[model samples]
Target: MSKYVLIGSKGCGSVVIELAMLKAGAEFELEEIPYLEPGPDRDRLLELNPLGQVPTLIMPDGDVMTESAAIILHLADAFPDAKLAPATSDRQRPAFLRWLIYLVSEIYPTSTFSDDPARWQLPKDAQDGYKRTVDQYRKTLWGHVEDVADTPCFLGNDFSAIDLYIAVMRNWRPGRKEFSQSFPKLTEIADNIANDPMFSGVLKRNFDT
Candidate 1:
């Protein structure tokens, strides 16, 4: 069996994990799941993860892991040579963790809510408002990151999982064009990743860009 198995769908946030694995040169199998349509594949995914979420990683020992940020961090630490994250002793480690968690905790939820406003349980008539609110919040979160982003990437010149996360999220609501116009710095980071041979192929495979 491969060292790891990643269950994911195209264009999902899971693509960040996929790109991280590719950069790390990890030997892993990709299991594509139809996350939107209910079928055998989705059922199989649910069997492994009750949440039926993509980006579920199955270790060789049969342990299952979920969450895009956690999986990316795990891969970074597991394969130190890849330098996908800052070392624990590095001064930038704190900043790295901070932005990564902020993206996962603060910004990620906005995409979830915007994508499925009904999940918030707001009145049917209020669904559009919910989406708009989430969209505005996403822009606000990215704006804050832009203001503090001093380097070409999120954590200096080095390309880390944080950049991959930002690049993937940039494709979400307020899409690439609008997002680029609003936060050129952040867009530059994503563009750099999107243009890199190491990552561009994976990005294109997942997003068809």
Candidate 2:
């Protein structure tokens, strides 16, 4: 089988794609890009994605795909039997798309900024305060999702890619303990995903727990 080539770094956004591909039982190879440092891996990654982002996927057909959400969605569509997402005709499709995009647009960027305050051009002394503010706002966003979330899963009984997202993201910012306390419902969803046989190994490997 022709393998999909996944370009990503450890403990980064690529964890989500890695879990999604594993769930789909897709044949793939992971190419670790040296994060932020210049070398052959960085050069190759830059050639594929100028943004220098992780989760850049090279499909079996040799086409390059970027963005975590898009790659996971494509994987779901390609491996229908895996049921990584709701079918387009399914009623839950709207909610699936809604929250997936919400996470990408709203919550993900805060991590981007907080992880590297220099990206926003903040001074060294102000960087800590900036990250705190971003982390607090992220908690608020989590609260909103938690309020609307269903037990055992983000969209209810069925497991979808959104749960994969929650599983990885909840581990970031203000720490998992704070996340669990601030948003119990979402924590349940993340916990469930973490425990699932399909995802457990990858989660452990990524988080190094």
Candidate 3:
């Protein structure tokens, strides 16, 4: 693709995908708009992403894609030079994909809920319901993380795209750091991946933007 335009938002898993694309040195352009507010840009993003969300990628030929996990995988699989994915010979593809899906499908959506009445809909009265829902989903996602705790890097020793996806997805908790600090391994990995140069500017671009 001549240009890879990325439609992303703050505190979203899309940041990881964009970071991976940047790390891979893939030849593509980034198109991200944070702050869920909309104008012409939001409308354009909706044209590509029916959900009206971020992590949308537009190819040079007008092909549009949504979903952060898929975006990261597509970039790595398409570019061998990037080496964001594992080798075909490796047998961890199954586990790698599992966590990738977990982050995208399970954890990413949980952030949309809020205990704060200022953030979500319903009413000041329904804030507790929203929080309860968020907790259930968050716990489920963490359980998935524990289930596959045996594997490092999600797909073995290598740092695949899944690692990047999870790191960004988990940043949503805000207080998640203090809470998940109990999980030593995950906390360590989070810190390690967060420290990578590939992700150095990603937090700023994706979260601070």
Candidate 4:
């Protein structure tokens, strides 16, 4: 049996990877870290991941993996029975890769900036403006996602890791209420996943809502 260890923070994008592992029925140990400042936990995390980011997975063979999208995609491939992703030969595979990459590359960076605007080294007077710009961009990005979303889910009928990722990311920035109102289709997909028993526990555990 392959051992899996996930180091992550609550309310962070890492929640999606954690949920994916659970839904996959993959046995894994979770280590939570504090984001407030550098401390013992963060120090320990750096030893495994030089960047010290959460959702770092210590694989059974002792290799380390980072980035939420990469980690979940790996899980989906490793545990085919979990059905977290479409098979490479599946017609939806290309679209799946497209949206997944879009979320990580486009939307995910905004969330990071929104969470820690100071990281950008903007002048004090410019911080709020930078955040506002990022917020508007995030909203527009989500609208694009809504435009192409399939009914009942992002990939239609089936629920995959992408939906799980969207569900968690929706809770950030504009938050659930505003996010739902702005992007109804994407919100519907998120709502479905939130209500689903497989994901409810992880949601409550991370977001407490």
Give the alpha-carbon lDDT of every model: 0.86, 0.88, 0.68, 0.86
Best by lDDT: 2
Model 3 lDDT per residue over 27-112, tens place: 66666575367688888877777888777778767798777766767777787676677666768767777676776677666765
Give the clashing residue pairs of candidate 4, or none: none
The C-alpha local distance difference test score for the whole of candidate 2 amounts to: 0.88
Q: By how many angstroms RMSD does model 3 differ from the true structure?
A: 3.0
Cα RMSD of all models vs. native, in order, equals: 1.4, 1.3, 3.0, 1.4
Q: Count the backbone clashes (under 3 Å) in each candidate.
A: 0, 0, 1, 0
Worst 10 residues of 4 by lDDT: 30-39
Q: Write the per-residue lDDT of candidate 2 for residues 31-120, one digit (tens) a residue.
A: 876658988888888889999889899988889999998987888889998788899899999998998999999999888878988877
TM-score of each: 0.94, 0.96, 0.83, 0.95
Clashing residue pairs found in predicted model 3:
6-31
Q: Which whole-number lDDT from 0 to 100 does residue 54 have in model 1?
A: 84
Query: Model 2: runs farther than 4 Å from truth?
Result: none
Q: Model 1, 94-174: lDDT tens per residue? A: 988898899899998777767877776778999888788879888988899999885588777876888888788888887
Clashing pairs in 1: none
Order by TM-score, highest first: 2, 4, 1, 3
